[model samples]
Target: MSRGPKKRTLEVEEIISLYKKGESTTRIAELANVSSRYINKLLLKHNVERRPRGHWKRKYHFNEDYFKTWSGTMAYILGLFTADGFISQQGQTVSIAQKEKDILEEIKRELKTTQPLYRNKSTGVYMLYMHSKKMKDDLMNLHGLNPCKSNNVEFPYVPQEYLHHFVRGYFDGDGSINFKGYTIVFVGGSYLFMDTLQRILNDKLNIDTNLVTDKTNYRLFLSGRKTIQVFAQWIYKDKNLFLERKYLEFMKEKTPLDLLEDRKFRNTKNAVKLRKQKFLEQLTKTNCIEKASSLIGITTNTSKQWLENDSDLKEKVNILLNNNK
Candidate 1:
């Protein structure tokens, strides 16, 4: 007796693509018109790894009110959304990208969704994305985010109690402290969003900020030691929720004005005047070369040679050159 044609699995590329897009084993099987066990076998055959069973199980009965409440975690999620999340109208999907895997996992856990975070091998960027019309609607209607909200995004009305936490999250997303420049600066493409943040900084912490318009975006800079100190203290009050590296830098002992003054003092011409005074004095005298050479503890030949060759450093560096002969 002759058997029917042998069953062949779907293309390996197609299977891998669907799997990476957060498709479950059962869903992949259904899409391919094969049994779930067969799909698992194909995945193994193709060297595609499987996620944990717990990662594939759906936990919450997702609804419109799933993300309606205002909480610290919610505030943080919103902040992350503002910084890196994208809403696609075509697919009704919400996608967030980060280099850190833990953050992507945290977002996945908070949503209680059974979606895998996909990794971009080229950029090493991990993206946690899902398709949900409810989430897109919530963000659009509740938070007032637009489909393409790069340059026109606004800060949503968060509760008074959770506003600081929300701002902390936003800061973690886009804000950075320049320890070298002694400034706490927030950078964003949206002018309105940056302005709103400036207002929040003033009203919430009584810290003033300067708004600067860059070529591509807006910058809200809280310069000076006192201002940045207040900003750091207010935002980092509950340090557990923020990016640890940034928080640690903000909590560092050095003050902005102290660093600024140190830089200023070092860069000023007066700072080096004392050291060059003897050189200048010697250069002005009749035996100027000899005097400067004595001060520098160098022989007259090296000083004469250097002075004769380079006029710019004739006086200042004559004392620094030494002669062996």
Candidate 2:
């Protein structure tokens, strides 16, 4: 017989503990004087499966989700572009000329095919086209769609001309507005004009501009046929307005208005009040009323009014405040 049955070579428990603590199989193998394959086998024997790593979660994930709730369709379109590799989240800048060219090419390719454009079953409206087989495959893979389903079959032709017409009309229509340098193209109908515009500016432009659309009422001032003209002029005068105050003087001369009398400008004042109220509420909830008030640059009286007007909010504030005290 062998010497004590070869010491029984036991390490299953040690291997499992290391695996649970996220140690790599190779490292565990090295430490345990076993092959990586054996370490993997030990992991399998213990019924442990390694999880694939994912991209880092962003701080703005919550804010982005909230914004999406307010602008679901617009968010969907943006997500489509992102899925199609037209946009990047890494803060790398692409030239406007290059983006326009790439988008045009994508439009051309998309028009060549017959794809089932998604229709909003609830509203009886056609959503956008899926365009390519690759896109369809991606959707199938990511969303796990059944390929046999026939509800949203791909169309055979793209109707490129119709698409072009729609694009031109959509931008030229009543919902369009111009921002500092670029034209703010709004999609959807009249009821969604302001909301759509705000979402576009906030989500797309804010990445580069450092300007938050929700904080300003620029959309209100942007309307009618003159909106395009103002937008184009702004673009012509300062292509880099978002990065610098390059065209402020020029824009002021071209579109001078009484800030006090302008309804749009006045809306900004209301926004400020709302923002302060929210800041105070958050501060009180966190029990850092004095610190948050100072950090928010708001007066105590304003914070007090917000607390008094909303009794429910006041109760939350008191809890936070007392807990800290």
Candidate 3:
């Protein structure tokens, strides 16, 4: 006599646990190695009220094809995921933990999923979880992200056209702007990752910054008002998505005229620095700091600052002056 395959046995607790954890019924069935009907029966036995049919399909719905190509939104989300997102051992479960629920809500809207946000009361962190095998595979194979990628994560190749959008996304996740210091910073665990960012920003974009270690992690710092403003313009270029908290804070400090003037007068930072040196050197010929500053079309105080920054130039000026005396 041919015996039928043994029926897969499932416990009520197992089904309930998956359900409470936001697993869809179909996914729960797959996890439990049973039919969806059996899972539903067990849920009913435990007095778990059934949601309307197809609720999970609707709630968990998202454009799984989102990561297939390099678009602005896709690039931004990928960058955000690189910084703050986590993939499970199975590579099917993905999550983002943020201190602000508002950003999570915005990401939720963007992913087009209704997955509920969970909070860790102890840490005051809000978590958004998403489950999709295809999405995970795209991130791993098409992109270079993998499970447990924190310290070893490498900078994924991004098209030059979409790079700024990707950077904005990463910045929203692992970066910050300090209005008080007129500073912008990005923090990551991998030295290579920080180095790559510095290379791109410094060499490609003409935005300069220094890289340093911030305790266990590494960081890149861009300080001073004009630099951060220029970076903000570059990162926020497309006028699309962002972590609104950071964006709104930046707007409060920004205005059109400020940027225009920064570009108009400064021209190139190196040029400005050299021009300052040129005028300061002219102090010997003018025999007066005020006259030299006037020739440079700048305030005398500003010329003094230029001298203060260059010890060699200052020493040369002092020697010429003492010789004249």
Candidate 4:
């Protein structure tokens, strides 16, 4: 008589290693060249406390079919979800957390759901959650995100047109901009995710970024006045989709300032150059350096110095003045 299939053998270390790395049962099965049922059996044998099926409460519900359409709001939420949302293994609940209550409120409004927002008093974190498999599946199917996603979460397949909005949402969730030096940084625990974001930045916006890894996570940063300015405008194309405080911080970065003796401004070199050209255009209409200086709120001496130092400006101003006369 032919013997039944040979007894399947599994190495304890191999199973434990994959599970510790946050691999799902399905993923572990693929890697181990075994069935998902076998992987579950090993977990049971090891007494691993697997994730529960559903959330504790079931007071509210939502029609997450709204997530099917591709809109800026949806794209933004997708980014936010990828950054902070988690789907339960039961596929019945999707949860997101942040420190901003208004963002939670905004998410409720966007999904048109009646789910109540929760706050952790000890941690000061605000949460918005729902019991909807549709939402979870939408995220997984449309965006390639899965349940129990944390450190190993990969970047989603955002549409080419909505990439900016998607990244903006991600930034609003996990990014920080420094007012002191105007540095833009995005922090996450996934090296793969950061690497994909860096590639998108270069491909979509032509922005070059540096990828630095700390002990726990990765940090993607853009430095210098020019790169920061470009990235700021690129991410915040839709102001309504972002956190108010973060948007205000960006506004502070975008605000124009008076010219300094060193020809400095709170902007990149290109922006400063553009402003100076505009100032000269206004001066051209006046036909006099003193009047132009007055129009720009700069002293006549400054204008004279600029004219002496910048031959291009001098030539353009002279031509305009002659034509006006």
Candidate 5:
């Protein structure tokens, strides 16, 4: 027998409505002009489960139109999503889980979703899941993502400038670091997915790595201290969000402007000029640009580009060609 101010039937229904809709007791009480304790009693009397401390503050839904944009944050989240996100075939539900809640927190913030991160009691994995047909359709129609995406997922198109953010997000999701062995590795189920990623990375970063079959899945490994260090610098460049523990693991051996000297020496004007001189010397010896480029371990297109871009090189090459004739 709870003895309190007896509310009208309408008010009680409205209070229940608010409670069901995730309104906090204090807020509901304030809205209803009732005491917090009275609101709690009312909710309990009606058999509504009490939320945990601060749980009511969580938004149970996400921004439905979040995946429609192409920002860096969106790209990164998409990358993370591509790595570990799952789509349920039964409905328009998508979920991403992580061992570290920090990355999930970052994803939530980026998606502008306050959706509660639920933890599995058995596996201890924190997952942020949402049910939105529009979002799921966008993911499928726009990115070609589907249910049971583990084995057949394809690499989605990412803009060139946001490539690092995307790959960093993917790394945070599916990549690992071997501190003692000095290796950076990425695991994936599809061979094409791994191969496409490898080609992009190799073309862009000049990273030499091994792409091999790892039992069922495939792995791309960038081994050795120099390769891993360069990769860390490349991926972590101007990054705002990443798995902090992984970032810290890479940071343990890094210095301020770690690759400054290497970049300086390699990018010096004198170095380019000297290289051009060496190419011209090779051109004089070989006569054919392709042959000369091969002799100097440069590409024929590079030799052609240098000749096109440098008038001095063009004149010297003409002189060498006339001599060869």
Candidate 6:
């Protein structure tokens, strides 16, 4: 015989109420003797959302105060990195003091114009103010940190010397070159200087050597290993003509009076005389001798006599000719 008509199922609202009141879907389904799928379908049909059991909702929200604090702290860290002598703009050197001063001024200017908005209800303005204070403290701590002092500190203006020491230190530390051997290191600022030194030392001094300059770094080496300072002084005193030309180029970028500040050039008659002659020769080569000598500080005729009498200059010319083949 056919069974009586099936009983109608309970409405979705009733199922949802039971579920909200902590009744399991399985228990509800059993009580109604309906499939669990039907219970789930009914709940969805009524637009009831079911969250996973035992999951906790997030208790915190990010506010403007938190963002400002974090941003300010990050800014301070960036400022510190700059102040601590980061290489920038194709390795052009900048001092820590200069970077620090610039950042401090910028921060002060920003603070003057910036206005805070949307404070945290629980933390209030204290969180924001504390962040600012923390930034200041961090900057102060960075300022107190001493800069890494190098042996070439006495000659800050001489970039060649700075580069030389750096290279030497790097090589010595890395065991790339032995300092104790019968080794000659050609040091200079530009490739021209270093190249010239390499040739001159090879020809004149007959020394076995390596040319340590910036070019090597670009092609094969790493940073913080250039020692142009010791190399420059060595070349000047030892009368390395290749290095002398490099020094001349370096000096040409500066005034004669400024060049005189270098003890290697200033203390020696030969260095001073060689520099003056090289200056005139460079001017003559560039067709600027007439205009250059017209300046109040320069004496072209005296420079000529110095060049004529320079033994080192004569030797360099002879060496160049010999190596020309």
Task: State which candidate has the highest TM-score.
Answer: 3
- Per-residue lDDT for 1-325 in model 3, tens only? 9977646544567568657766777656654567778788888888987777756533467767668878888788889889988776642676778887887787778778787886644467777777878888888888888887888888999999899999998998999876654667788998878899999999765765766665578867775557677788888887577888898767766457255322234659788777767675667676666545544445456667867997887787788778877
Per-residue CA lDDT of candidate 2, range 1-325, in tens? 6644222133577567545544455545544556768777767767886646432222111111221221222222222232222111122111111112333233323234232232223334332222133444433443332233222222111132232222222232222333332333333222233444344434532321111122222122222223334343433331211212323423444444322121222348678667666675667554555334433434345567878887876777777667777
Query: Candidates ranked by TM-score, best first?
Result: 3, 5, 1, 4, 2, 6
**Candidate 1 wrongly placed segments (more than 4 Å):** 1-66, 254-325
The regions of model 5 sitting more than 4 angstroms off are 1-59, 255-325
lDDT of 1 by residue, 254-274 (tens): 645334322122435664454
lDDT of 5 by residue, 232-270 (tens): 887788887888888877777655544432222265889
For 195-309, candidate 4 gives per-residue lDDT tens digits of 9999888886675676666567787766545556677778777655788887776677544422212124556878647756867877767565544454443445556787888
**What's each prediction's clash count?**
0, 6, 0, 0, 0, 15
By lDDT, the candidates rank as 5, 3, 4, 1, 2, 6
TM-score against truth, every candidate: 0.61, 0.20, 0.63, 0.60, 0.61, 0.16
lDDT for model 2, please. 0.36
Can you write out model 6's per-residue Cα lDDT over 89-169, one digit (the tens) per residue? 211112222211333343334344231221223323111111132333333343321123221112111133233333322
Q: Estimate the overall C-alpha local distance difference test score of candidate 4.
A: 0.71
Clashing pairs in 5: none
**Least well predicted 10-residue stretch by lDDT in candidate 6:** 218-227
User: TM-score of predicted model 3?
Assistant: 0.63
Compared with the true structure, all predictions reach lDDT values of: 0.67, 0.36, 0.74, 0.71, 0.75, 0.35
